[model samples]
Target: MEDRLVMDGLPAFGLEVGAFSSVDLVTAYFGRIADVSNLNAVTDPLHGIPILIKNNIASIENNNTAGSLALLGARTPRDAFVASRLRAAGAVILGKTGLSQWANFRSSNSSNGWSAHGGQVFGAYVQNQDPSGSSSGSGVSAALGLAAACLGTETDGSILSPAQRNGVVGIKPSVGLTSRDLVIPISEHQDTIGPMASDVKSAAYVLQAVAGQDPNDNYTSAIPNSIPTLPDYVAACNPDALSGARIGVPSNVLELFLDFDNSRQVEVTSFLSALSTIRRAGAEVVENTNFTELAAWANSSAETIVLRADFVTNLASYLSKLSFNPNNITSLADVSRFTKTVQPGPEEFPSRNTATWDAALDAQSGFGNTDPRFFPFLQENLFLGGEGGLLGALDRHDLDAIILPTSFAPGFAAIVGAPAVTVPLGFYPAGTPTVMNRRGNLVDTAEGVPYGISFLGRRFEEAKLIGFAFAFEQLTKVRGTVKPFVVPKTEIRRGV
Candidate 1:
């Protein structure tokens, strides 16, 4: 759509024409599948719908730049598994959405939605609202109905946080449920891609198209062999699945939110109400399901050690696969130099340094998972997500899912590679104070800025979590209530 909007047979048009009037020029229409996909049209749920992928996901037609200037013209060998799956499901490739530069892995204290290539992306709900990200652009795209839905990659909070902030549904799949081939890397162990859509069922529909094995991504081979085929995720949108379901709430995890963000406690006002709603829907809301070792895990440097070690190696692997590399960047050290030494100041060095890259390069251990100390650090995380965290809470409480404020929920599952879904919870009140983040430009709180509740569970349990999210979504229909300040109406009519 970016290409379509900027280029055509015409000369000067957008200068005078309103965005709504240039509708025909904006849409990137493609041929609808007949026998192209192996499945029937009836079975291809996303057939004919236009879907957007994040800028990082490699597509042959688009540059897989990860919003960095260095890779601006670089091409990919083929579509990412996410993109290929969308094509296989008879969906149209709408285009790419912006992301945090290097999926928010580039620098410390960087703004959530700013990318050197994509510019600063803000939420539509309020004036300069912080569109929580790496996946910020995708979340905002869905929030504004730019397409049916948009796909976003998550190594952690990228998908979930932005979805809540944007008043939409975001599914952060358990790692390995979707292929990461050709997508930009942060940490291979945690990186996974999922859909951000207007609602739970819509997200499920999108997830159904892409959830499967791809030989290119060996991580996907981890899908249980016993399950010859994946479950019918769309059908799993059972509105009544919440009935007689046992859901747990971790007070300890919730307590840590105060340290994470000042407004974290206030933001969960509706989350407290969501518990009552869950109870009325016939789900038992088990309280005080504590992650006793959460404090210890949070205080430890285990997660950082894992991410830094993984990143230094994983990033090089991604760079090695580029079909065309304009800058001859084959390593993080090369990328760092390009960002620092490049004449035009495109990388914003003084403001946003390559400190993260520097740290990764300086990692005491050898390349990532191969490091001898890697397993011990990984085990520390496993303990947090497993016996000490989300997994442990589930088994200890005999729970179907764990519910928490979306802002506070992603970490436990992230460390352990478990699935989590966030649905619209509530918005800040009309008189809420405007708050700015460390970046000094991005707003953290304001009137009508959205928040969400999350349902997290074991790996490969996305179907069950989606069911619960669907029930909650149907009950609330809260997405409709909160409207953006400048509502975008993407009515594709005839060209002028």
Candidate 2:
């Protein structure tokens, strides 16, 4: 199956850049099924399943480039904590998938799927449409059946956005639930590895395998006792799980798109249709709920300040740990210099320059732990995004979870270190006009795009989110497995 997908030129879509030998993969597949009884209970759900680890996640057998030219050909010294767990659970490590260069942190105008090392990744449904960032290849590969499931790391919307755009299920677990050790970093405050799969069950299976405490990451040491004793998530995928579930619908999110004319109407109608489905499933939908304080914090300079500072600090820390640092690149400044020397200029690698890195360095220059402004920034971001924000809204509404268009709520969950699960809502019709005429002129002939709805839960409330997502998935059956792209013989001959 893996060979067939590779032969179809799925690599051109940037789904996979490198993989283990077929012999090693087969041996591991058989070895896992044979060893499962001792390592796991009789119900080792992921036994013999093949999964792809995102390139940024360390894997000893595959290159861990994080989709950057600067780290090309780099090899991991050990498996990432998640990767080790996947192996222990009897899953085959298929390979490393491509990603947005530096997880889409290199430039403001950079394309979502474009990587300096792997080129652009196209969407599963439409060849030319964007495959939303960072986790672009992971989402595409899962949707197209290239792998049983794929691991994707998210900071903000990296996992859910691509899953939404590609019509797949993505679960961004709470920060401490998944270890970030051995993965490339953007910000430790928000970064987490999660699963992208064709269905909620598969995502849940992957999550069960990869999630747990890790000695290397101090954050995991404090995991709530509730998480450790939780039941198997695969057993929690009840079709009637939404019955009596209280969900809040944030009106501010809808208002953000209310002025887009027909597109806005279509999206709103779709959202309302989803609400109808939820009601029919016996869930109470609380309408017009607003995250008033969250909106203010999201719009403020606090997020930018913290992210910029953390990116420089966290990335520098990760770089220093790399066992195969051939370039002797020890800091963000070294990375900037390497990019300038190797890639040269914007004219040659138009969207892959180091402008964002330079800007982050400048902003973070005088920042330190002892600085009064530094700790306050972190404290305020957590306070405003957590207790005073999402948790407050949930308590105010007496809600079990919040549902919004996938695009709107990921940032909220990310900032608060909460969990979110995105499932396919529906797809816009082909040729549906997505853009409005600013001069009051209507435009036609736009490509269809997939949209998803997200379930946002309190910190460490992954079980609730998964149950809701599974129930909604079973109710709608909106997700479809995509066919692999067939490379034309002529193009194949032309070496494309």
Candidate 3:
């Protein structure tokens, strides 16, 4: 299955990457499959499943490039905590998938899926449309069934956006639910590894295998010992889970992007239909909740200040732990200098410039977490995104989860370290361009594109989110219908 998909033109892997040989896969199945092995000790729930991990997450056998030329040959001495857990649970480590260069933090104008090391990753549904990233390859591989499931890390929309664009199920667990040890850092506050799969159940299965506390990561200490376990996650897939649930629709959030002049009417219509479906499934729909304060913060300088500061400090710390740094690339400043000497100039790779990195380095000048400016950013984020923000809105409204258009809701979750599950809603017709009055341009809108809706819930409430997503998925049956792309023989021959 893996080789066949690669042959069919799926550019989902990074350097020195290869799938497990057939013999090894068969052996793993025989040793761990419940039907093949009856040993009481062999109780791995993910037995025989093949998982493709994102390149940024360290794997002992694969080079962890984090989609940058600066770390071209860097390999970790051990697997990331999540990767080790997956292996312990009997999952086959397939390979590392491509991602945006530096996980989309390299430049302000960097195109999604365009990595200096792995090139551009295309979407399975539309060959020429944007395959949102920096989880580009993971999402595409899952959507195309290249592997049973894939792992993706999110600082913000890295996991959710790509999953939505590729029409797959993506769950961004609460920050500490999955350990971040050995994974490349964007922001400790927001960076988390999650699963992207063809369905919510598969995603939940992967999540169960990976979610746990790791002593190496202090954040995981916050995860309660009695947190939802694997069985709870599986059981939550009940189709009737939405009954009597109250879902809030923040008009302030939706209207931020659903302007009439934009070409997102199709998306708006699909969202309304989804709301109707949720209501039909016995979930009460709360309309037009005012989240003006939270929405304002979403566009404020707080996010930029916090993320930039965190990126510099966290990335330097991560680099300092490397067992081998052949190039001595120890800081963001070094990375910035290295890229300029080798990569294409701004004329071509507009997003690979050093401006962002420079700014981050400047922000961290002799200032650690003690910087007064830094604390305000974190304090404001906690207030607007925490108890006084998203949590406040939910508590005040007495809602189960907030249902927002998939497009912008992920950002809110990232800021607050909340968990969110996105599932397919529907697709727009061919030639239907996305909203033109937006941050990025829509590519190949002439080809039909898929849109998904997200269910955002309180921190560590993944079971509820997964259950709600599963119910909606079962009711809608919106996934699995989109056909995978098969490259033309002529194009393959020409290496196009």
Candidate 4:
């Protein structure tokens, strides 16, 4: 396969016409990824496609380490539900991409894409770009077309942020849309698995393969029973889907992020220009729709209180279910000890420290979500993200979906487990000044760095978001406008 060859199993992959065999595609993608995969008989949209999964998601063929050395060699009894679904849908498991250690929940001081086992993953957009968290590897690899696309999990910004930085399309489904069983957890309440792909349609195909209710993950039970069969997400990619659709731009959300991350001006200008695109595309734009208590909501401790408590409980549950544990790491505390004690060390325990885990453990009250404090915090979260936040904004503005620059969107939706999709919006100008990451090793912002626009909606509404994203994606086609510092040499390594 060639380098940077963007595909979402586009028509004429040569498989259906017998131009090449599934084995041929596999061998072509060999250097890009590898693993145990059987050619399936069915012809799903994802069939015969090569896809990479983030390291945190468990699989039988490789060590499911979540980018941490502590769980090295640990084995999962079976593939994570998403992995099995991908295989069943005929996607070849190319290989696992590296991720932020413990999905970027381990250390507050850590770099976005750094991992103990994989070192650090740098984006191809520029030298040492911050590759944005948790799903960092998946996002960058997708943009460079390392595989057909890559899978990622989001507790909050894991998938979206990385996708935006890498100039790829990412869909962060509602909490229960995809199963979490066997995928490592940060907070069961917030964690979700979704795809980061070169385009929205490809993402839809990847999502179509894995989405549906799973008995193992109770959260999936929340998916509406009225719809007996999974919706055909690919069919939802209507170019005219945005025509007559009511889309709102929450000015307050944009206000909150105006000075965030120091990469502005272009985004603000691009966003203003994109609103005209949205209007010209026939979507009714509702501007200045404010989140009634956004400031109060953002200032509250409810989200943090809920996440830390859930993490303590969720991590223990995931470890307990692991079939084989080399380190006997049964709880968050046990894992913490291993990180600090492991010597000749890449963990950099003394300097980095387990501050995030320390805080989680400190909040650990010998109970999980069932604790008395949990429900109240959840209630506050729902009020903020639900009634007074995005939900209220949608209902009050009588909108189909709310749009914001991707940077401003994730947190609000995360609280309510609402679905969101981030599509390429714009890139920084050529003369833009560079901004270095906190650790000062990676570039946080600079000329040619890409950003995105997100469409956030009510729970289980991904199909709608996909349609709007596809429409916006088609309108701007921004990904192609920005060129990376380095483009891959080959689009494909053809196999005979």
Ranking by lDDT: 4, 1, 3, 2
lDDT of predicted model 4: 0.81
Cα lDDT tens digits, model 3, 373-486, are 688878888777766566767888998998876776777788889999999887877656443212354363434577889999898899999999999999998875666454
* Prediction RMSDs, each to the true structure: 8.2, 8.8, 8.4, 4.6
Estimate every model's Cα lDDT from 0 to 1.
Answer: 0.80, 0.72, 0.74, 0.81
Tens digits of lDDT, candidate 1, 1-496:
3323422112124435554332242342222111111111111122234577888888778777788888989888888988898888766576777788898888887888877776787776877777888888788777766666789999889999999998999999989999999998989889999999888878988899888988888888888732247988889999898999999999877777776766766676778877888999999999999997888878988888788788878888999998899989888888888888876787788688777777777745445667787889998998878998899989988999999999888888999999999999998887788888778887888878899999999999998999999999888888879777765433444343
The digit string of per-residue lDDT tens for model 2 on 1-496 reads: 2332232211223223334444433344334323322211011123233677787898777667777667766656789999999889766677667687788887766667666666666666654556777898888767655556889999889999989888889999998889999899888788899999888988988898898888888777656753457547788788998999999997866776464333545556787789999999999999977776745674667766677677778877888778887777777778777777774552235444556677677754545334567677788778777666677778888999999888676877888788899998887765675552221222211355678899998877888889999999988888653332321221111112
All candidates' TM-scores? Answer: 0.89, 0.83, 0.85, 0.93
Listed per model in order, the count of residue pairs whose N, CA or C atoms clash below 3 Å is: 0, 0, 1, 9
> Considering only N, C-alpha and C atoms within 3 Å, which residue pairs clash in candidate 4?
1-491, 1-492, 1-493, 2-490, 2-491, 2-492, 3-490, 3-491, 34-94
Q: At residue 479, what lDDT does model 2 achieve?
A: 69
Angstrom error of the Cα, residue 129, model 4: value is: 0.5
Q: What is the lDDT of residue 277 in candidate 2?
A: 94
Candidate 2, residue 264: CA error in Å? 5.1
Which regions of candidate 4 fall more than 4 Å away from where they truly are? 1-12, 32-49, 225-228, 259-262, 363-367, 493-496
- In candidate 2, the residue pairs with backbone N, CA or C atoms under 3 Å apart (3 or more residues apart, or in different chains) clash, namely none
Ranking by TM-score: 4, 1, 3, 2
**Candidate 1: where are CA atoms >4 Å away?**
1-49, 225-228, 363-367, 492-496
Candidate 1 vs. true structure, TM-score? 0.89
On the 0 to 100 scale, the lDDT of residue 42 in model 1 is 10
Question: Which candidate model has the greater TM-score, 2 or 3?
Answer: 3
- Which candidate achieves the best lDDT against the true structure? 4
